[model samples]
Target chain A: MTNNILYSIKDLSKSFSQSNKKVTALRNVTLDINRGDFISIQGPTGGGKSTLLQMLGGLEKPTSGMISLDQDDLEKLGEAKLTNVRAKKVGFIFQNYNLIPTLTALENVQIALVPLGIKKLESERRALAALESVALSDRANHFPSELSGGQQQRVAIARALVKNPEVILADEPTGNLDEETRDQIIDLLVNLNKESGITIMLVTHDSNVAKRANKNLHISNGVVTTRS
Target chain B: MFFTYLRREISKRKRQTLLVSVALGTSIGLIIVVNAASAGIGDAQKTVLSGLYGIGTDISVTKSIQPTQGGRGFNFGPENADSSGASTLNQTRLTVPIFSGTFDGQTLKQIKSTKGVSRIAATLKLNQIIFKGSIAGTASNPTTPQDPNARPRGFGGGNFNIDMTSIEGVDTSLTNVGPLSGVNIDKGRIFQASDANSQNVLADSTYALAQKIDVGSTVSVGSGTFTVVGIVSSASSSPETSANLYIPLAQAQTLSSNPDLVTNIYVAADSSSNTDSVQKAIEALLPDSTVSSQADLAKNLSGSLSSASSLVNALSKWLSIFVLLVAFLIAILFTSSGVTRRIREFGTLKAIGWKTNRIVRQIMGESLVTSFFGAIIGLAIGVVGIFVVNTIAPTLSASVVSPGRFGGAAPGGPGGPGVPGFQPPAGGFTGRGTGFGRAAENATTLKLHIGMNVSTLILGVLIAILGGLIAGAYGSWKASRLSPAVALRSVA
Candidate 1:
C-alpha cells in the first residue's frame, strides 16, 4: 500500500495453448517490487521468467490472479488502458536489443517518446540526451546493423530511458551479448537503476546477474522462490 | 515517428521496393499499352467518319430511292420509280421525280432554313461515258476503250473495265463546304464560281495520277471539254464517290438531263454537339430523305473490321481488370512477406507503445510509395508500346460496308498514307444497286493515334495507388492483429 511499491503480484498464473495442448508458463507467482529496486527473475529456458516480466510490464494479461502496477490492477484495465500504462509507466529491454532494424539509434530512441505525443523537436532533444547518457551519442545515427552488439544494447538502453518510465522491464537484456558487452550492459541497467531510482526487473538465466539485484526471484516450473 | 521509420525501411530495402514496383509497374504498363492501342483504334474510326462526312460536317442528307406504290406506265414517282428506269415524273412528284433522286431548290431551301443548320452543300452524283483516247465531250453515246488494258483508275478493273465512270457536279459556291470541300488539292486549285459556268473541272488525285493528267490539261468528260483545274486527294471518297471529275452542279444537271437537282445534300451543323438536333431537323423537313450523322456513318461501316475493334475493346476491358487484380495481389503478397520477415520489428514497435493503427499506417505508407514508382514505370512502358505500334504498323486498312453503298477504292499513291482503298460494296443495302452499276467500296486506311491523354493518365495512376493501398491496408491490418507476445515468442 506504500507509495514506494511499484508492483505487487499475488497468485499470478499464465497458460498458453500450444498446438492444442495447454502449456502452463507460470503458476501462483507472488512477489513485491519496491521503488528503485533492482530485481532479477532468474530461470532456465521456458521457466516463465519472460512471462513474469511481461506480466509486470502489463504487456501480457495473467490468465488468473492479480498484477497491480503502480496500485492499478493490470487485468482489470482495458486493452488500450493497459497499453497506455505500458507506454507511460514501463519500458522494455530485450535480449536482441529489439532496435527497429530500419531506424538509426537516435530514431529508435525517439520512438519511445512517440506514443507520448511530444513535439518532434523536444522528442529529438530528449532522444539525443538519452543517447548521450548511454554513452552512444556518437553512434546515434548508426542503424542497428551498422553498430556492434554492445553499442546496439547501449542504444536500446537509451530507448528505454527516453520515455523515463518508472519501471524498466529487461527480458534477458544481455542474453545475446559477448561476456564483456554483457557486463557493460548489466552495468548500464544497474547504473540506471541506482542513479535514476528507476525500478528495474531483469530477466536472465545467469544466477550471477540475479545475485547482483537488490532482490532475486528464482523460478523453477512456474513457482517463484526468493533468494536472500 | 511512424513515417520516419517507414521512410528508412523503404529506402533500406530499395532493392525489394524496386522489384515489387517493377512487377506491379509491368502489369500496369501492359494495361496502359493495350488501352492506348484501343484508344488509337477509336480515333481511327473517328477519322474515317470525319473524312466521309466532311471535316466538321456532321450530317449527310440524301433523298431515299423508295418509289411510291402507285405509278401508271410512263408515269413515275420517287417511291415507284428507279432513277435508271424508263419513266417520267408526274406534276405532283416534281419535287423528287424520276431519272433524278436529287433534291430540288425548295427542299434545299427548307433544309438550309432548319434550326442549328450552318452550311449545306448539294451534289448530283452521275455516271458518264468514259472517253478513251478520244476527246469527245458529248453525252450522246458511250465510247469504246481504245486501250482496254489501260489501268482502270485505281481498281482491279484490268481489261474488263466498266465503260462509264463517276462524276460529281457540286454547287460551285457550296464546294467550299460538303464532302468534296475538305479534301487536299494535290495539284492546282479547286473549282471557282467563275468556273461554274465556264469549262473547268476538278479531278480526284488518284484518278488524275493514274490517268497521267494534271492541271491545265483538257479532258473530255460526258459531252463537255473542260480544263482540269485541280487534282484532289480524298480520304473519305470511295471509288464510287471519288468522282473522276468534279463539274459545276448546273452543268452536271444539264448533262444528266435532271436540271436544278441533286442526289445527296451534305449539312454542316453549327457545332458537333448540335449534330443530333440538326439531323432530326433535316429528317423532319425532308421526310423522304435518309439523314445520317457521322455516328451513323461509322455505325453503318460495320464489318469484319469492326470485329477487330470489338476485339480490341473487349481485350482492353478484360486486360484492365486482370492487370488491376495482379497489381493488388502483388502488393498484398509483398507486404505480407515483408511483415513476416520483420515480425520482431513489429513486436518491438507494439511493445514500444505504437498503436495498432500506427503500425498499419506505416505499412500503408510503404505500400503507396512502392505503387507510385510502379505507376511511373507503367506509363513509360505504355508510351513506348504506342511508339512501337505507330512504327511497326503505321497505317492499317480494313474494308467496311455501309447501307446502299458498294465502292471501288482508289489505289494508294504518293498522295497520302492511311487512305482506305474505297471499293463500292458488291450490292447496295436495297437490292436496287443492280439497277445502276454501283462500284464496290474498299476499307479506309486507318492510321493509329495512340497517345496518353491527361485524364487517362491520371485515372491509371489513381487505380495503381488505390490498388496498392487496398492490398497494403489488408496486409497491414493483419500485421496489426499480430499479438506482440505471440510475435516475441516465435523465434522465426
Candidate 2:
C-alpha cells in the first residue's frame, strides 16, 4: 500500500439472518484503492456489491474487519465524527437520484453542504457551480419532478460533487436511465473523475459501463477478483 | 440555518401545520377565557366580603342555637360556656343588662382608668307604645261614652301597635363602625358632637321613608323630639330595624326620664390593637355587662360564605384543568403523526451526515413557530369573547377584565376593549347561584376577571414545544437506527 491509499478493507464481512438462517453478503474481502482511482465493481445480483460499497462509504459498520479511510479507522470514530467524515470525505450518488422533492436542484445540492456549516449564500453559489460542472446550471432552480430522468441524475451527481469529497461512490447511478442517457451520464462521471482527480467507485451491471472505469473488480459468491 | 429548515418543513406540510396550529390555538384561547371568567368570580367574592365587613376581618362569628317552641332563658354561668346548641340558629343576639344606678363621679373615673379598655359610648334601647287613635270606652268604665259606630277591639280595649327601637349613642371619638360607618349619606350632615345637644339625628333612609319624614322634620321618640339632620343608606341593617329613629345616646338617656340607666355600652378600639386583650380588660371593668368585638362577628359571617364559595371555585378550577389537559393531549397526537410521516426525509438527512441533535432542533423549531401563532390567534378569540359577553350584560360589572384586574392582561391586551377603569363590584363573590346568574347575563365580564395571565401562556407554549420535540426526536431516533444499505435498497 502506498501513502496515496484513500480506503482499504481487509476481511470485511456482513450477514443477515433470514428465517433463522444466515445469509452472508460479503466475506473476507480485501481491497485497497489509491487516490484518483476510478474503479467499477461488477457482480451478479445479491453478490454483496452494494454491501461492500456501503461499508467502504462508512455508511455501514462491517461485522468483522479493519476498514480505514486515509489514516482514520471507520469503527473507532463516534457517531458525530463519523457523520463529519461522511459529509466532508465521501459523496454518494444513488440509483433513485434521491433528490429532496421539496427543494430545487440547487437546494438539493445545498443540503450536502449544510452539515459542513457553510453559510446559505455561499452554499448556494457552490451548489450552482457544482450543477454547472454537470451542465445542468440552467436547471438549478427546477424541482426533481420538473426535470427529466437524465436531468435529475445530473442534478444528483452535482449534489455529490458539491461536497468536494475525496471519493465519489455511485450505487447504480444510471440503473434507471435509458441506454442513451446512461452513456451520457457515464461520460459525465468519467469526465468529472479525470478533471477533479476524485476517486470514483461505482457498482454497475452494464458491460459497456464497466469498461469506462480505469479498473474493474468482478465479484461472485461474496468474493472479488481484480482485473487489470 | 435551523430556522430555514424549520420554515421549509412547515411550508412543505402546510395542511398538517395548519391543522395542528388551529387546534392548539382554539384550545388555548378557550382556556384563557374560561380562566378569566373564573378569576372574576373569585374577585367578586372578595369584593362582597370586604364591603360587608372591614378588610381587617377575614372571619365571622354568629351564635348557633337549636329551634325551640318556647322562649329560651338566658344562661349566665361560666364565661366560656359551651352553648351546645344545634347548628341551625334563628339569629345571634348580644344581651346586656340595664342598670339604673347613678354612676358616682368616682365610678366614671374608675372606668376611664381601667386597663385594656378603650373608649365606650353609652346607648339606650327604647320600647315605644304606639296608638293609632283614642281608645273606645269599655263597659267597666261607666263615665266613658263609646260611639255606637265604633267596633269593640280585642284585648287591651284599643287599637294599639308596639314598635321596637334602639338609640345608638355614638361618641365623637368612636368613629369607624364597620359597615355602618360605610353608609353613604344621601343628604344633610352626619351627627356631629354639637348635634348631641341640638336634638339633631342621622336617620336611615328606610326609617325616614316609612315615617313619611324628610330632613329637617322633627319626630318624637319617647320623650325626645329629634330633628333629622341626614339620611343614610345601609345594606347591613334589616328593613324592619332601619325604620327606627337614631338620636344621640345622651339625648335618649335623658329622654328615658332616667339619665342613670344605660342599656348597652358601645366601644371603639384601635383596629391594629389586640382585640382579645381589649375585650378581656373591658370584661373586667364592666363585670356586669357583656363585651363583644367586631372581629368575632365578621369571622362568623365569613366562615359560612367561604365554605360554600370554596366548593364552587374548586369545581370550576377542575373543569378548566380537564379542558386544558384534553387540548394538550390532542395537540401531542397530531404532532406525533406529523413527525412519523416525515421519517423518510429525516433518514435522508441523517444519511447525509446531519447530526441527530440537529434534526431534533428542526422539529422543535417547527412546533414552536406553529404554537406561537396559535397562541396569538387564541388570545384574539378570547378577547373578543370577553368583549361580547361584557356588552350583553353590563350589570355584571365587567371590571374583572379591566387592565390591572385579575393579574393584568393576558400577555398582550385581552382586557382593553371592555369598560375602561371598570372594577368588578367590591363584593363580587356571591353564592354560586348568584355568580352564575350574573355570568349568564354577561360572560365576557366574568371571563375578563378569569382570563389567563402571562405565566399561563408561557406554560402552554412550553407544553406545546415539548410535544413537538418528543415527536421529532422519536422520528429522528428511528431514522438513525436504520442501516444506510437497507434504507438505500428500500428506496430502489
Candidate 3:
C-alpha cells in the first residue's frame, strides 16, 4: 500500500511575505495520491491550489511539511537533486502555455529532454511521437505565436509528455482557452491519464473540469476539504 | 541544444548585438592604429637620429672656438672672395675666418687608446672667401631655404664685398663610414684615402651647377686650382640637401694654409646601444669640448613634428586603457539589458532543469562570439587607418631642431697651419677668433614610418577578449541567479 502511493503529503503549509506582511496560502493540508490517480485540485482565487501544484513540481519549497513523491521527499532533496526529480520523474503544463516563443512546437517539446542530454536526432524523434500523442504532429513546425490558444496548450502538453515522466503537474492548463477548446483539452488529458496510466494532478477554477478527474481536492481560504 | 537555441536568440536580437559589436570594434581600431603609429615613430626616431648624428659613431666631440686676446673686430670676408657660394646665406651672417679650437694628433691618439672607443675619424671645417669665378646662374634645387637673410645693420667689415664659402676637410678614408655613409655620388665617385695627397676634388652638384663647374674640371679653391674628380650630394651641404665642394684633407689644409689641426673628431662605438655611456665617457675625456649624442639630437628636435610625436606617444600610452574601459562598460550594459528582457526565458530554462552554470556558459559563449567578430573588424579598421595616415603624411619628419648646438657639417676639414686670407694681410692680419667658428647647430628631418607591429596587434586582440569576458561575467551572474520559480509566478 505504501509503494502504491505516488504522493503522501502531511501538514503542508506555505506563506508569502508581501510588502512586510505574511499571507498564508496553504495551511495544515494533508493529502495522499495513489499511483495512476488523476487528481484535480480546485479552489477560490488565492486559495493555494496553484501553490500545491508548484510544490508537486518541486518548483518551490514549502514553509513546513513533508511531500513524498514516489519515496523521495521533495523537501529533503537538494536543489540539484530536486531538479533531477523534476526532469526525470515529473513534468509541468502551465496556464499561459509556457512554450519558448523562439522555438518551433517540435523544438519546444524537444527542450524537455535537454537535461537528459539526448542526441538531437533521438530527441526530435521523441518530440514528434509526443506531439503525435497530442494530435499536434501536423503543427510541429509552427511557433507558439503561430498556433491558436488550444493548439499552444496542446504543444505545452506534448512538451510535458516528451520526457516520459511518471506524473504531470498542470496549473489551470486549459483556463486560457475558449469553452469548446477547453473541453477538448480536458478530453485529451483524460485520455492520456486513462490510456497511459500516468498520474495527473491539475489546479483548475472550473468545476466541470474538476468532475472529470478521478479525485478532487477543494480548498477555501487556505484550508482543504475533500470530495470524491 | 543550447547553441541551437542561442543561435536563434542571437538572430532574433541581431540589431542590439550588431550595435554593441560595432561600437567595441571602433574603439579597438583606434587603439590599434594609435599604438602602431606610436611604435613606428619610436623606430623612425632612432633611424633618423642615427642618420643625422652619423651611423656607427656613438659620440661626437667638437672643439669650441673662443676669442683670443689679440684677434679683434670684423674683417668678415676677403676683399677678393669667392662670390659663387650661397651657403653663407643660410648660415650665421658672421662669416669671418677666426682663430679656431683644435684637437691635436696627440689628443686623437689618446682618444683612440681610450677603453670602449672603437674607430675614430677627424674633420676640420673652415669659412673662406673666393674672389674668382662667379657661380651665378644655376638651376636651383627644389629644397627650401629655411633661414632668411636678415642682414644686421652694422655687421661685417666695411668696404669688403666677396662671396663667403664654407669648406670642409675630411679624412677621405672614413667618408664611407658614419653619417657620410649615406652620401651618394649622384654623378661621380666620392674621395678615397688614396687621394689624400692628390689635388683631386669632389664638387657638390648644386655648387658645381651654380659655378658652372663639372667633374674633372679645374676649379679655383682657396689659393689652388685642383682637378675635379667626383660630384656628390650630401646632407651636410650648406643650404640643406645641396652639395658643397669637397677636396682631399691634405689639399684643403694646404690651400687654407693651415696644418696639423682638426676642429672635430668623430668616434664610432661597437654598437648604437652603447652611445649614451660612450658619450658620457667622451664628455669626461674632453671636458672643454662639446659632446653630442644621438639622444641629444632627438631631444633638441623642435616644431610641430616634436609635438606630434609626443602627442602620439602619450595617446598610445593612456588612451587605449580609457577607451577599452569604456568599451567594456558598454558591452556589460548591453548584455545586462538583454538579460533584463529575457528574465522569463532564463526562468523557463532553469525550470526545465538547466543548471545555473550551464546558463552562465551559454551567455559567455554568446559574448565570446560577438567579441571575436569585433576584434576582426577592429583589425581591418586599424590596417586601413594606418594606410590612410601613411598616405597623407609627409616623409622625413623632425619636431625639435636645435640649430645652435646641433647642425649638419662635412665629415672632414683640416685645421692645420694658418694662412689668413689677405692677412687682413695687417700685421700680416694675425687671424684671431670671432666666436663663430663651429656654430652650435644641426638639422635632421626624418620620414615617418607608420604601421602595425606584432606587439600592438597582440595587444589589440588581448583587449578585445578581455573586454568581452569582463562584460560577460556580469551577464552570466545575472543569468545564473534567475530563479526557476519566476516562470511559474503570476504575470502580476
- What are the per-model C-alpha RMSD values against the true structure? 10.0, 14.3, 9.6
Choose 1 or 3, whichever is better by lDDT. 1
Interface RMSD of each: 1.7, 1.8, 1.5
User: How many clashing pairs per prediction, in order?
Assistant: 39, 26, 35
lDDT of each: 0.73, 0.61, 0.71
**Ten residues in sequence with the least summed lDDT for candidate 3 chain B:** B427-436
TM-scores, one per candidate: 0.74, 0.67, 0.72
Query: Ten consecutive residues with minimal summed lDDT in candidate 1 chain A?
Result: A203-212
Q: Per-residue lDDT of B1-492 in model 1, one digit per residue for the tens?
A: 767877897899998798778877887778887787787777777666655556767787765454333331111122332333221222211112222356788988988899898989888877553212211111221122344444323321111122444677887876656757667777798777777777788887766766788999997655668898888876553332345678888888876678877887888888878889899877778787778886777666664446657878898999888877877787788788888988998888888788888888888888988889888987787778777877886655655444433222321112111111223333312121221233234356655668776666777788778867887888798897899877877741
Give the top-scoring candidate (DockQ). 1
- Model 2: share of real contacts kept: 0.47
**Runs in model 2 lying further than 4 Å from the true structure:** A17-23, A218-221, A225-228, B47-51, B54-57, B62-159, B162-177, B180-185, B188-208, B211-319, B394-490
Per-residue alpha-carbon lDDT of model 3 for B170-254, expressed as tens digits?
7888864443554557666777779888878777565667777787799666667778887665443222221155666667666
Looking at model 2 chain B, report the run of 10 residues with the lowest lDDT sum: B399-408
Instruction: Estimate the TM-score for candidate 1.
Output: 0.74
- Model 2, B203-266: lDDT tens digits are 7665677667789998766556778888875332222222245567566556656465544344
For every prediction, compared with the true complex, DockQ reads: 0.56, 0.49, 0.49
